[model samples]
Target: MDVSARWDNACRASLFGSFSLSGPDGAHIPISSNKARALLAMLCVAPQEAMERDHVSKLLWPGRFQAQARASLRQCLLILDRALEPQNITMLEPSHTMLAIEPSIVRSDFEELIEALNDLRIQEACSLLATIGNKPLLDQMDFGDQFRAWLKIQRKHVEGQLQIAVSRALVALDRDGDMDGHAQLSEAWLACGRADARHWDGKIRIAVLPFEQRDAVGGPFFLAEGVVEELVSRLSGVSALAVVARASVASVANSGRTIPALASALNVSHLVEGSVDRFPDSIRITLRLLDGPTGVQIWSHRYDGTLEGAMKSRPHIGANIIAGLCKAIGVEAHTRAARTMTASREAYSLYLQGRALTYRAIGDGVLDKAIELLEQALELDPDFAECWTALAEAHVNTIVFTPQLDRVERSQRMADCAARAIELDSRQGHAHSMRGIHEWTLGNPLGALDHAYEAYRLEPNNADVTARLGSFLLYIGHTQAALPYVEEAIEQDPVYGRNFAMLCAAHFNLENYDAALAAGQRMIDLGMPGMWLAVIEAALGDNEKAVETYFRQRLLMNSVILPPAGLAPMDDDARDAYWTIASRGICSGMEDDRAIYCQILDGLHLAMPDPCDASIALPAIWMGHAELVMKLYRKQIHPANMLGLMSLWTDVDPIRQTRLHPSFLSFADDIGLVAAWEKYGWPDLFPRSSHID
Candidate 1:
């Protein structure tokens, strides 16, 4: 053999799944003798490492006499040489005392896989995994006990490397937003029990169908839906019950599915169906608990009361219905335990009206109207815990919807209302959840998590609570861990757009751009802000889409439209700079502020300046300019006001780079992220593996 041609890329071998050899022209080179193939396999396992001739003989022909084994080994080598010589392949470099496979010509699948993983070539490793499948290493080759032992160790090492590579590949796919690839690999991993189940599949699932409204004269449209919402919220507190969220139930509410079919579609064991009848001054509610599998009515009840009486008697009515359902299902009745608040019928009616508005965005004035009604209800009955919770939510909405408003003041007010609600009724999970949001808005992630977990503990089955907690986890950098919760929440409440918003953020942070775009579009369809979608388009380098989305969103918000005609002719640098300023103006509705808008517009031509001014930092951060945002934080945004840390785990390209920057550790330490991570476990993007001293 011409040993000098060992480095030639003329031939290759595959040792995983099955063994095979191919020459440079892609013709299969047949090695008919079993011992000959075995010799080649051994050499291919570690092409760079030469094996002594005697050792190779003992392993391939164990228990044979030394002379006989040596004779067999030499025959196998001759067979291999004859097979390769036909293709002009020189794959061996043999010495008098040692044998070796040329590292270049005889390169194998196993060898390449290890190298890909070692070099952190995640995409290549993922592609290689398809060829590996589930076959045992060297499955086609028969070997002696000594050789089998060597194969076992080799297989074990290969398994370990593949596991790590697959994991990293999944992360890469997620970051790249390769949903199809992630789904396929995830399915394979799940089949082999490599992936954890998102949630306990054994939990008892139940769906509360939308209540039918049967009124001669139409009352408020929210009345019937509100009843279903209340029941769903109340039932979600029962840890043993996995109550379906309002959105999912609403989706099929009018689907006209039979009871059993509805149950099957929702994957639930029991179904609660009901109808509401509103008369001139009286209301009646009829409910039925059905055996989902058989579609048999297991229990039934009717409650009748005057409008005023119904509003005041709802707690008692809801508790009775819950108690009956729980008993029918063989569970204890824990309905509204420590959850009752308010006696005024009028106050309760106002609370219902106010609470309904918070569920969906109707118009610009909806939140203001909701806040007004909730305040009036509070005045009528000062200690209504649920009303206070609803008010806090409306306030949070105000802060989010109107950026030019005093966010700090509004956030503090929201915190106070949530705190009061908790004080009045400590067991209300929604109240704790609101308080958690307040903590997050104020940039105290650890405190936010503490409250969020408490809310989850209080309402282990609440879909809203689950989704909110998941959103918090994503924002705080636990991208992977947040996935299960987001998925679980969606399963329970698939129609709720806010949960989709959370899903979008999770995918974006994971670098799953396509998936993020899909989720964000879904969010917009469901009547939520398209701001995140615009940002995602920008991250994807789709400047046209991003610009169009920004203008469209501004129009939706009733803000002045800033045309991108100038952006079309600008170079990449100018476009980015213009966008950074434009997005800030659009997002903040600063154009309405006149003076501030002019100041920002004047600086549209300037580069991102050092020591970013505090006023522009928040808007800039939202626009994905985290480098400037971080500089602002380092200079003046920490300790006294920790709001800069709010976007710490954002997935925009610039922001993602910021997290990997060396200064991030110091920023994390200064903002108590390290301490929070230590106590609660590190986030996915910044895992303990990346922890710096």
Candidate 2:
């Protein structure tokens, strides 16, 4: 048989990293000499597996006499032969005129990589390339100067081919509208780009810590947090600045660290800290910007103004801070801070209080209180675009984070408020982002994409906008594309639990289970709900851990139900019944749990719920209730039903197995999911049928 024909059946040799020959039985024959490895690598990259004896000798030992160089080459070949002999493999075929590897007897990873690329098996090619990550050919070997120079050229040529193959694959995937595939390829491309040191040139990084309240009397306690929030928001508008997220700064603010320490922790070059003192009619704001490394004060200012004047002066104050930083860093500011201000002092204060309350606790009627306060502010000054935006966001959060209100009603209200904000200020990124969320919830991906892209275009450096874009991508099953945005958001605000949760979802969708688990844990550590963590644990096959996580989530939900405490109202009996079913499903050796699970399914059917309620199907599938899932699929075809695309999730195993069943096929056909999967490549876990790739 020819070498190519026998390649798969023959013993393999890997020369990319180290010199080793492996037999069919998988034992390795190691070759330790640098010259021997280089010789093998030279042949590995050869146009053919053979080279003329004199030509090889001249390349390896150019300065030596022809006879001396040939002798050295012969010695290196002898060493390589001896190494392969132990594996019962005649790897080297040497003659008086030409030398080569016994093509039918040996193969290498390089050949396999080439074959994979030629066949357009990009995932396999990437897997093979990962084995050679960042390592040059013959990486640990040191040969003679002439051979070393040849090796350098060969290494570059090989890497260049690999990169070209990757780029071609990316183009093909993009042309096919395979967003996930494009994202993975983009990741590999970015890894290559990161090798260049100038990738992040001329970027200014800063973190604004929460301003402290020097005097706590008279003014609302949330004033300090509110001021820092506004400062961070205004500073985020500057084009040249990379502002650290408020969540990340808040995480380290109470650590009793100096300005330098805080800056170091946040990975920023500048730090902003200050105090607010409130009196009957005026507020005193003291601000200082400090150098991150040396803790030197770069600028300081104290502004005392009437309540209305201070509320209106925030943009000017923020602009001055940006100017000072620009002057200190020798970089010109490209944009000025612009904020929509309310003429009513009470309205501004009410808006600030509402904003602060919205951040207090999830699922606690804090968001509702925020809405009430913002409504009061709006009544005082109906044209307050900022207040409208804040209210819109709060309404959306009430739907997303709490189960108290009707989702349909809140979504409509959120849309209205967002539209009002956009009418008042066409360029408000927050309004655009809020509208994007509303559109996504309404199952309009194209509209969501337009708004998300607009939000990012308007405020590229805004961490919130970046995170929103990431979320929208994930919602549309473009998990890989969502990665960079979420990562940037985390880079900007490391302490933000929502960003971490989004990252967890992105990693989970990518089948990076370990990274998903880590991000989920980080979300839990940061005091966010861990519903996703439970799913991650379940996916990782840790039933006990998943059950424990479920219990913790249950406790978290119950803990927030303090009656008459301004928290969202909950149906205790219904919540308890739901948890009971979930807990039983996760526990082992419980036949009764299975019966109870079936009973819950029966009751859900009997209740005759809305056909559009697709969320319940996810939990049913997670609990291995395939019948319920099929029923849900038959009832509704909502875009929010991501289960069809999330084939890699362990929770979807039962669903995947049932994809060929008559009911499932009908469901898929009726919902147009099969055609959707055909448009993009079928997910890895999808069954390979005649209609699928």
On TM-score, the candidate that comes out on top is: 2
Candidate 2 per-residue lDDT over residues 267-348, each given as its tens digit: 6667888898877667788878776645778677777876567656667766776676555544566664476767787887
After superposition of all CA atoms, the RMSD between model 2 and the true structure is 18.3
In model 1, which runs have C-alpha deviations exceeding 4 angstroms?
1-200, 209-226, 247-273, 280-282, 288-300, 305-316, 323-338, 441-443, 511-624, 631-653, 661-663, 669-675, 681-693
TM-score for each candidate, following the candidate numbering: 0.56, 0.61
Give one digit per residue, the lDDT tens place, for model 1 in 174-293. 656778877776665555432323333434567888778888767453467657767787787666577877656665667777775576546566789889898887788888988664
Q: Against the unseen true structure, what C-alpha lDDT does each candidate score?
A: 0.66, 0.65
Structure candidate 1, residue pairs in collision: 175-510, 175-511, 177-512, 177-513
Whole-model alpha-carbon lDDT for candidate 2: 0.65
